[model samples]
Target: MEAKAFDTRLFKRILKYTKPYKFRYYGVILFAVSLSVFAALRPYLLKQTVDEYIKPKDEYGLLFYVTIMGVVLILETFSSFFFVYWANLLGQDIIKDIRIKLFKHMLSFRTKYFDNTPVGQLVTRSVSDIEQIARIFSQGLFMIISDMLKMVVVLIFMFYMNWRLTWIVILAMPILVYITRIFQRKMQIAFEEVRNQVANMNTFVQERVTGMKIVQLFNREAIEYEKFKEINQKHNKAWIKTIFYNSIFFPIADIISSLTLGAVVLYGGFHILDGDKFTTFGDLFSYTMFIGMLFNPLRQIADKFNEMQMGMIAANRVFDILDSDKDVQLDGAKTANHFQGNIRFENVRFGYIENEEVLKGINLDVKKGETIAIVGATGAGKSTIINLLNRFYEINSGAIYVDNQNINDFKLESLRTQIAIVLQDVFLFADTIHNNITLNNAEITREEVIEAAKKIGVHKFIKSLPGGYDYDVKERGVMLSSGQRQLIAFLRAYVSNPSILILDEATSSIDTYSEELIQKATKKITKGRTSIIIAHRLATIVNSDKIIVMDKGQIVEEGTHQDLVTKEKGYYKNLYDSQFAVDLN
Candidate 1:
């Protein structure tokens, strides 16, 4: 997680999002300034009451002054309310926009990014990290502006009332600021460790939960529990360390403030006793009150300083995603109006790292209306091939051409709009069945959705449900069986009617009955369209126009099923023999 520390430049870029709401920010500042002025006047009114109204036993004048003081207090409260409301509103809006953009940017990232980054850490960044930043932008902003302004006004009033006493009180501020800086740096480090530990805990929780069935089957519950306990313990320790630093900061600030108050009393008392020309008891009292007010906001600001530092750290992490250069840029012209489904990979070499190439000078051609099946052993770059075809990763060398044009030359949306993929792991939203099929597009009619569902043989099952197409599927479609989930996935992809279809182990998870149904539906859906099927089960591709056997990232053997099976020494022949032997048993 330390390796994931966000760049400060990226954090600064995130601050630019606040530019649009500058007027609201100015309103906040104005409110804070008005409150500060009101705060500064309170002491003066008290001084006047002591010197003029109280000294002469003037009850009416004292009552008038008290009423004015009460009015000022009311104004300060209203100003504070408006300041907080507006700042919070702006903060929430900015956070919402940032969250939306960050998610979108992450989705746009190359698949290689996720290959290295954990999904739980990414989720942590989007959730808690964004929230931490939001707190800083909202409450933190109000406190900073109000404290700084109030401090300035208090300083001016203190100096005006008595310069000699003011100097003594102000001297403690340099020490206070130094202490604040030290605490800020230390808290920043501690909280950063805390954030990383939280991410680790989240990753552990997600992995354990998602793989609960596997863990149970393997009888590794105790092992996972210990692992999670260790990560959670680390997070707790980090939190304690952060609180320790924060606790030290406030008490030290309080002590310094106490010492400053003692000094003010000693110095100001001496001046009054010595009959100093400009100092009066009333003025001295007012000066002391103003100086005392200084320490409160100062200590509060110091405490909040830690919060701001923590927030900046979170902001930096979030901004890293927002500011990232989207790997699949759609800046190019949307030059391709329609795809003929011609795909060619020419001398393409690609890898996650510079030196270790996963795809090595690969060459392939698929003509329109051809259905090709790609087969390979685990980690032989089978999934990588599909990922590249979808532009989820870029080729390090050479090119991929769609419809005989370099894929990079077309807008990413335009290129992707022509392709549809159904993955083995089906992803369904927690929404109505119709929304899942049409993907919540109001423009896609209910009739069109049912037609696609029927094409994929899912209409009957969906209709069997009590709500029919309007039925709600729980998160990840947990309400549906794996085969039902696959049926809905097929319908979604089929409904898109993409020019090029990719079935990446799509039928691998479904039951044999469902697979047969899908196999039938695919014939109608894939008619006169280019389709690529990647399957572990060889029987799934027996009807493909060609079957390619990939080994070590290279096509070792390729031909129609009969031709490849007839080649006695070929990899496909061995694969078919092994599966056919299993089927016979």
Candidate 2:
């Protein structure tokens, strides 16, 4: 993210996004040049009036010059308007494209990526940081180019009138340029600091708000508030350095500009008194206007360069995410439009982090339409099996097969579409219950949603809400009880009509009545589908076609409930007895 004096490569990459709107893109640039020419031309026209008309006392000549100058002003005004309009339009279009590409890239990433990265950090990159990149067109890169063009044209006019005066302006430029270089270097560091703090603040606020329930439940309101204040103070402190440098640099730039102008005036007057025929009042007048024009752009360049620097750095950050394709879900050429639901894991091994295996040398097979229940202690790798089966994260070694063919051979989308999952901690969006259930899938009709909910025995409860199916659930379904959200998640999985259904601690938190209803729903849905159920409650898995008891990522027992229960001190019997001893007996 460190930008050199000028990063041509990064700027070129940013420019690639402008291809879709090239008309506006090039139109803005053309306007920049025309406006600069117009700006330089006006001062020269006035010089002509002062020398060829005013000094000669020619009224007709003055009228003609006035009319021409007015025409130039009119053109400059229109050009300026178009320049601003096209520049902003081009900027907005580019960012819109970049944001879309970024989001799509993120969507293709494996769950491993999201597991490691903060959601708030991704949000900042997608939203605010991209907005800064837009400033490059509207106020940063192009604006700097336009200003430099203005200075170049103004210098041409000054040199054409009197070379010695042009020399004075050039001599004054290095002082201002030197100061600006120092200012820009300092500001780049400050702006980077500002961006980093902004991202930090966004991440902190988002995480706290999302977990406000935990914060309040733990009585940490005052502690959280103090933490927020500290972050806020750091954010302000980063901004203050930029403001301080700006306050110091601009005044110095102005004083140097004024001194240059004063020197030109003094030298020109003496030249005229010494009988140098080339120096004239008209020349002095034009040179004064040219000096102001020259220095004004120089002053603005410092600010514009800062904007460009920020945009470049922001662009680099965005590109980092785009280039991270190694972990993206690769779409295979093979298709699995309909899964036979025969799942197999042959010597599968994986870890979220390298060399730390969560599932080691795992081999599993579930015949089509069989229901397998996995019972384990916490972190015994029960859920890891489900994740591997779905290809949410890739295996480090070996392969998963569906219908005896490699799962990776199937197209990723087609493979996932046939699997539906309901988790213990259900997540719902801030939307109506209908939208949350269907996830805004246009293909899933409202009637279909109702039917699925009815199948899961939650339709009556949903209808009991104020808006029935239309009731807004709010963030993470906070408006409803945890059991109610679980019901909605169950309904979501049911509506998919997947070949393979998974319940990962799905009924662990359900109330007795809801649990009974879901049990009924579970039987109905799992009747002819391959099902994987992970549970801590041993009672819930008693009817499983096969129950696998695991410990420390290895299977210790596998059998029907009665067979394992009869074994003395067997893993399954131990778990069953522990639960019975706790309450169920």
Candidate 3:
């Protein structure tokens, strides 16, 4: 989307984050004003020391004026220090709150939002982009205000000293202002491109690093490196464009400032020589200093304003996420405490993409404590049923009920708290094994975690590792084996004491010993809970209370193991005979 010229609404929204620390914000402004006043007085004091004390040849009076000038310099230094300190403090505090809020808002987005969004893009927004926002407070807005205040105070003193000389300097300001406006416009577009390229580079690096094993296995390093070089070139070019604009604009400003300085000196010298008492030597010296003071801040203000524009561009990107309507709106208000395990999907239809339905009018029913097995080909909608059951995605049409009330009628947290899924591709955070198991849930104590691990039959294996449960997984559990990660996933689900358990191909890809342990753990955990198993291995589900055979998003057969096997051309029978018969032979 095209960015607004000056988004007043967005500006107001950013201001809201500062309200919590308004006292500190006020302190920054107060110091900025004090600094500006001191800055203006320095040149004026110089003028007085020259004209009234030095030129009159009074040593005591000159010493007195010099001491006062020293005092003013000290005060100005103090003011400048406090201004910088408080402005930075305010920026850090405000950005801290904003970053936290942005992270929490991202957490609230639905599964589908994450499905299409890149993780590195989100990381850029959370880390790099939010940092730019902090500069808006520290180096951008507050600095711009302080610079403008300095300019105003300097202009007042110059006019008071000699309005005619002041006008001479003022004549060159229009050119500087015109150049700055053009530079700012170009810089805004360049900065936007830079931010986008940074995100693209981050995405590429993150993906390549994450899948480095696969890249190396396929010998695609040279190809991927070439791709990275292309992206890096674009990133470099975007930054160069920003530098190019800055180069053109700052020199133009310098030329204008120098011309103004020359004009002030020439005009003041002529008047002084005229002997009409039109301008004093002290006035000429002070006016020269005042002109530098005026234009120097204006130059810095241009730089600060460019920083502010980049911040606004980042704010636009961040606010887009905050304002998105794609979040899964939680409409259910009913709490699901002490939930019964019964679940039913009635005429449910869903599609991750529009017009390409994954689950088509699926109907399912499970009793309070039944174990149901769903078996199908890879794309036959078996796992989609579990996704819908957890309310990860909204149904395109129809209703799902838990304990006779619509699933949508339950509060999202309460509903999710009662359901847990252990996937085939298990994920573990880079934390202690204990933390990974309990997920830092306070209610699941250390003792209870150990007990859950013991109950799941992985306690001995865990204790065999270094530091036992205290061992760090180290980034997606790379330190652990696939079987070990799966075992951890099982323990995580078991500790929750969920009313409904989902094992989505949870045991398919694992070593034999781990499979044995998981099979034992599965029998214990699913004893009284409503469990749904989506498995590719036919042997695992033979003893389930009910077995469902699905093909092309529709269930074609439903019965016990023996009942389906007796049918000559049944989908389930064919699947079983093809695998189990070979095993027996």
Q: Which has the greatest TM-score?
A: 3
How many clashes (backbone N, Cα, C below 3 Å) per candidate? 0, 0, 0
lDDT for 106 in candidate 1 is 85
Which candidate tops lDDT?
2
Better of 1 and 3 by lDDT: 3
lDDT by residue for model 1 (187-274), tens: 6778889988988988889888878989999999999889888888999999999889878888888799888888877877888799
TM-score of each: 0.92, 0.97, 0.98
Clashing pairs in 2: none
Which sequence of candidate numbers ranks them by TM-score, best first? 3, 2, 1
Once fitted onto the true fold, the runs of candidate 1 whose alpha carbons sit more than 4 angstroms away are 1-15, 266-281, 284-288, 326-331
Clashing residue pairs found in predicted model 1: none
Give me the runs in candidate 3 sitting further than 4 Å from their true place: 1-5, 581-585
lDDT, candidate 1, at 275: 84
TM-score of 3: 0.98
- lDDT of model 3 at position 560: 86
| Residue 124 miss distance in model 2 (angstroms) | 1.1
lDDT of 3: 0.88
Over 324-390, each residue of candidate 2 has an lDDT whose tens digit, in order, gives 9887997788888887789888888888888898887878888999999998889888999888888
